[model samples]
Target: MPHSNSPMTEVLVAADCWRNEPDAEAVIQRAITAAAGNVDADVAGADLAIMLTDDAGIRTLNGNWRGIDKPTNVLSFPALQPTGARSDDDAPHMLGDIAIAYETMRREADDEGKPFDHHLSHLAVHGFLHLIGYDHESDADAGAMEALEQEILAQLGIPDPYGNREGMD
Candidate 1:
């Protein structure tokens, strides 16, 4: 495993969107807990800024950063040193950032019939994992990642996202 020169994981969460939901803080903390547990890492003194923004902001970000020109669910920019980059011995490493689109998240929750908190928690954990270099680009990779996600969510008291016997629709 690659570790930043720092001793903890940093989370920054910013919410610029309308939130009818009142438990964003708790949701974010739950995510942080799940992420930290999964990696067996601790969070050092850090700043986690979560933004609750609309599709416009997300779309702009997606276009500028990812070249996708679309509003996606979440995006993570990891500040972890590049694959072979050296760590600065003195400063705490900065774990980049995670951005989530609020509307999309809510829509997904409604569509899936999963509680909003559960869906948000899942995304938060997922984003944090990405910050630590986890990805699901291939079928096998997705299976592994999803399994870990399921376990983490379960630990957080979320139902099995894939426990249904039929399979994903």
Candidate 2:
């Protein structure tokens, strides 16, 4: 088991339509740990929905929530307001929702010539950061976020997911 400064995070995963993947819960737990390490916030709980459907399902969700019809690798619906404000005052704080497209992630990993575990870890960490109000809309912002991702991935024993040709086999 990974050592966590805080107690176990209630990371609820709903594989509504994914397939051909083993140990979804374990993968999710690793992601949560990565997230917790990067941020100083407490991850009391999270509600993540993993859909293994085609682009159409993701498109619908993207359009309805994000107002964009394109299918993305992962979409995070953070249960937090900007400035890291909490919406609830009496509860342990639901971290928010993350939706991942199984096909898209798998394809991206193969095309990028990276291992599935590495890519999945990257995406999960990315989504968790979003839940904690981390965004990369600029080069400087991207650099900071990417560096943080690299650090967390390192802690999890995953190589640089962005590509480390020198270390790859």
Candidate 3:
């Protein structure tokens, strides 16, 4: 648990559709808060940015940063570490940025037969975990990360995202 004096994590959301889908920002923020709470480390005072964009936007970013020409549902860019030691009075740590592709997310939800909001929340949690240094490149690492995601999603009243999948088993 974070110290009582620690500030709450600040979530800055940027999305053109947020006004139309009023609950989108709230869902993203809730996922971030829940995941941070469940993690072992204290990221209570961290700041993160979430950008909601279209598939084309994300595809371009993926190409530019990762050399992949496809659009992903979500992408996380962790903040670069600062060199040397500094005083503890600096501003809250900027955890990094997360971007979600609206079309990709919606398509995935439809394909998976899951609610759109739930799927969005899952992606938000996934992206935040990535920002906090979680990866799924190996079997052990993926299992551990999936367990954490299941726990956090359960707390948010969502069912296990990996259960009953065709190829996941």
Candidate 4:
């Protein structure tokens, strides 16, 4: 639903890292751009913020926002209204924020035996989808969301994240 004349989306990334990776910001920006392009909505004029932080930072945020005291890989805070309605035009559409935990993500990649970069891309796509109202609270919803993630990742030359895990005990 992107308008033909829509402007380019803006991505702002901030890394608050204790153990940082080279080119992390650039990688995240690429992932966000790719994910945004795949979405149905016209996000050409939207602005997205991504924060690369460690487990402690994300754990604090999770506690404050969702009352969870532990850290997760990624957390998305959507700015669009609950009804999916856009705000006023004067205000550039801020598509919420995505926070990623480095330790958790790296550990997960090691555990899964996947490349760190590829896993990071998957998480970025997953978080971007959440910003656009995608969820997996149910089996059907999970399938749809995972399918979209797979499609997006494929376009980015990344393998299916759930390929080996799916249908497993």
2 or 4, greater by lDDT: 4
Report how far off residue 8 is in candidate 1 (Å): 7.1
lDDT of 4 by residue, 82-113 (tens): 45555575667667888888899999999999
lDDT of 2 by residue, 1-169 (tens): 5545322544443444455567655776777666686677765454444333456777788999989978888888776533665566654545667777777888898988888877887887888787677889997887788888889999888888766556644
Model 3, 82-146: lDDT tens per residue?
67675689766778888898888988999989998899899999998898889999999999999
RMSD of each: 4.6, 4.4, 2.7, 3.7
Q: In model 4, what lDDT does residue 11 have?
A: 39
Q: What is the overall TM-score of model 3 with all chains considered together?
A: 0.88
Off by over 4 Å in 4: 1-19, 82-89
CA deviation > 4 Å runs, candidate 2: 2-17, 44-54, 81-89, 164-169
Give the Å shift of residue 159 in candidate 4: 0.5
User: Which pairs clash inside model 3?
Assistant: none
Q: Considering lDDT, where higher is better, how would the candidates rank from best to worst?
A: 3, 4, 1, 2
Residue 118 of model 3 has an lDDT of: 91
Question: Over the full model, what C-alpha lDDT does candidate 4 score relative to the true structure?
Answer: 0.79
lDDT of 1 at 18: 51
